[model samples]
Target chain A: MSEMLAHLSLGFGVALTLKNVALCFVGCLVGTLIGVLPGVGPVATIAMLLPITFGLDPVGALIMLAGIYYGAQYGGSTTAILVNIPGEATAVVTTLDGHQMAKQGRAGVALGTAAIGSFVAGCAATLIIAALGAPLTRLALLFGPAEYFSLMVMGLCFAVVLARGSILKAFCMIMLGLLLSTVGTDLETGQERMTFGFPPLSDGIDFAVLAMGVFGFAEVLRNLENPEARDVVKSKIGRLLPDWNDLKQSAAPCLRGTLIGGTLGILPGNGAVLGPFASYTLEKKIAKDPSRFGKGAIEGVAGPESANNAGAQTAFIPLLTLGIPPNAVMALMVGAMTIHGIIPGPQVMTKNPDLFWGMIASMWIGNLMLLIINLPLVGVWVKLLQVPYRLMFPAILIFCSIGIYSVNNQPVDVAFTALFGLFGYLLIKLGFEPAPMLLGFVLGKLMEEKLRQALIISRGSFMTFIERPISAGLLLVAVAILVIALLPSMSKKRDEVFTE
Target chain B: MSLNKIEAAQGWRVRSTQDLAAGLFMIALAGLALFLSRDLSTGTLRQIGPGMLPKAFAVICAGLGALLAFNSLRYNGEKLSGWSWRGVIFVLGAAVVFGLTIRGFEIGPLKVPQLGMLVSGPLVVIISGLAATDVKIKELLIFAAAMTIGCALLFKYALGLPIPLAPWLLGI
Candidate 1:
């Protein structure tokens, strides 16, 4: 305990530096701004900033990037509460009660609840990481290739349950994403798998390009196509803080969300993405008036926002300990760390105590910065709803194109992005959720790599999966989930829960 | 309201589109799987080969694609009409033009040479914006020029990314 305290103190010393603090501020501020912008997600923003992070000190770079990740989650809730546009997938739950609260002239209360709740969750998650980081890292290292693959399979299976739409369509999207991720050169044998001889195809598709093009640019096109959908809300930016009654309702949800987020955040997947969904579901299940959920329940905004932030912070644990990125953003974080010549793992804490502890300390500092930045800017964000879609779409398109091109100085990526954008928009039009596809794409790449390695090691023996207990358990769980998701009775139960 | 034929047609169209997409994806996955498995030497253990997992994934893709296709045929559902062709044409056409033009396109001797991030980034957006039914050409040109200049300054000068400025204009 004394040693941990000393390390934390050292961390604080490094984090409190003028340069580090300024970068954190910049990251958080930018995170909030972009998070407010509809259809522009944190992943794309992180990928775009990857090149820039190459120049910073490893610790400082990671600290700033980490701030941006959670800061965006905090920022996403503001738009969700104010205008009903969820800037990120995790923010979807925020829109349920958040938009309703806005209509009820309680936007201030909703926004305030989210801000405070997120801060609480962030603080708790930071503490949890400081206390449990070593142990969790140890457990994460036990995961082998088959285990990783099964974990990814489980994550993709969970997506089917998460998609608030047709299960069939969601599964299809997931499969499509996996297929798309398989594009480019096959890493193992150095053969082109899906690249039809286009030189750009040689590198395969960058998720950044796909995300920016499909979600960012396609959304702009979508909004422009339907002018009536653009200018839906223009409510007065009510009070800047939550009232006593609002706080009373939200406090419990924040606590619940934080606990749930902290536990799940330790998982070596996109545990952060699960936080909001699980929190919202838990809030509804525990609510006295469940019917009030979709219609501006303060608990909805508070719980999910908190969970989102907590999850975002906790995701760093795997990276900090085992060198595993739980998601694409974290993958970029790893790339950023590599650029700075700092290999992330268990040794990071021992070799660079200042950097590890400093990062953790900065996360806490960044959470406070979020409140300072987001609350006052809530009014400005509300004003953004009034911007003409015509102006906004063009700007969004331009930003996406520029961001994509900046990655590798490649025009082909931009063109590829355009292709995906069209494809994505088409999928949306057909009542398909794109979330599953994106998740599948990310998991598919890793799945291919791990599965190939496992097979190579085991001389193509399928029993290798069963030989590993942890991997076996994961696969069993995945199979069970697939079976459960397909059960007819579960669909009825799902409908009942969703409708309720 | 009872479902009309038009509504039903729309739904069928949506499902058919999805089916086609899924099918194409599956075919691609199968092709890749077949290729990946070609060189794999499966020994007596019959323990899944390196190509086995990929083959399984591909088969899953094919299976899912078939399911999607089957479902679409079984359910003659309707969906809302999607994006107008004009918008699609503008976005897609602009992209094609940008790709093709990167090799050679000149304006006032300031040639927009091949595959430069500096030139293509702004050009694609501006050209696409001008082509958009909702966008005004004059406004787009201004926006495009400003965006280009801003990008040039930001990426090229400030960030020191190796983005090539217009060939004739900057003599790079």
Candidate 2:
């Protein structure tokens, strides 16, 4: 404990440096702005800034990028509240009561609740990172390839339950995502799988291309299609702060969400996005007046917003401890770190204590900065919404194109972005959730590689997955979840819980 | 905003578009996966063929495509309809144009000789501008030219990416 405290003090010493603080501030501010914009998501922003980070120290660059990630989480709720648009997948739950509250003349309270809840969650998650990150890393390293494959299978099971539509639809989306991930070269044999003899595709699909196309460009398409459909319902901002009653009602949910999110955030794949959705669903189920949900409930906003931020902050655990990235944003951060010659692994803590501590410390400071910046700037952000879509969308288009192009400085990536955008928009229109698709896309490559490696290690023994304790446990959980979800009673409950 | 109104708003036209789009994409993906799965020559258990995992995934994708088509066909329920093909085309078209001009045309400020920034930059802007709801000639030209020049300066001079400035002038 004394050593941990000393290390934390050392971390503060580095994070408090003038240059690092400045970068952290810039990242948080820019992250907030980018998050507020519907199309300019955190992943794209980080990828766009990747080239720029090559010039900075790895620690400082990471601190800034980390700030941007959590800052985007904070800012995402602001849009979800003021307008009914969720800037990121995690913020989808925020829109349930956030925009509803705004329509009900409680925008201020919704914004305030979200801002405060997120701050608390961020702080809580940072503490978890400081306390548990090392131990978690040790445990995570115990997970072999077979274990990881099983864990991902379990994660998919959780995703199917949490996804908005039918379980079959979600399963279909996941399968589709996995297939897309297989499009690149096969790593074990250096053989091309689905490249179709296209040299550009031999390297595989880039995350930036997939994200920009699905989340950014597809969103633009959706907006343009229904310009009037989403007529900004006139909302008068009220109660610049959360009322006592609001805070009283939200405290318990906020704490619960923080804990849930922090734990899930450490899981690989898109568990960060799943945190808020799960929290919202949980909160609603436990609420006395469930009907108040989606009709302007403060618990709905506070719980999910807190969960979203906590998840965003704790998500750094995997990146810091293992070389594995839990999400795309962290993957880009890994790329940033790799470019700076700082290889991330379990040794990151011991080898570069300053970088580890400084990053953790910066998350606390960055959250503080977000709270200070976001609350006062709510009006300013709302004003941004007034900008005609005609003008704003073109800028979004330019950024998306430029960002995708820079991935390899190759035009082929840009083409993929367009193709994926069409694919994404079509999915959205078809009642298919792209979140599962994306999760599958991100996990697909890793799953394939790990499965192949496990086979290689075990010499084609299918029992290898069951032989490993961790793998066995994870597979058991996957089986349990599938069984529970398939049960008639549980399926009815799930339908009621989601569609309601 | 009422539940009935929301449900009424989503109709068959929107559902059909979604079905067709998702179905087509799935079919194409399924075809690709199946094509990739073939001709796998595995040597030994220790050294698994690269195509093995991908082929398995392809079969899974084909199964998913069939399932998606089946779902759409059986129960076309509670669809999120509101088709926006115009928006889709505009964004897609812009991305394609960006790729073609940069890679295929090799058109940039530095390579264009005397008319580099003046011509290539404006073209980039104009193409991006085409995605907007209304195409204003003056505003499009001004924004396009400015954006093109800015991008050229940022990418070419500042970052120093190896972007070709001219296609016709510097033929080796």
- In candidate 2, position A35 carries an lDDT of 77
Q: Alpha carbon lDDT of residue B148, candidate 2?
A: 68
| Ten-residue region with minimum lDDT total, candidate 1 chain A | A224-233
- Listed per model in order, the count of residue pairs whose N, CA or C atoms clash below 3 Å is 7, 3
- Determine the C-alpha RMSD for candidate 2 after optimal superposition of all C-alphas: 5.4
Listed per prediction, chain B TM-scores read 0.61, 0.61
**CA lDDT scores, all candidates in order:** 0.70, 0.73
**True lDDT of residue A360, candidate 2:** 90
Pairs that clash in candidate 2: B111-B165, B111-B166, B125-B144
Q: What is the lDDT, from 0 to 100, of the residue B54 in candidate 1?
A: 48
The DockQ leader among the candidates is: 2
Q: State the fnat of candidate 2 relative to the true structure.
A: 0.60
- Which segments of candidate 1 are over 4 A away from where they belong? A44-57, A181-188, A231-233, A243-245, A265-274, A281-297, A318-358, A429-431, A495-500, B1-54, B75-80, B92-122, B131-133
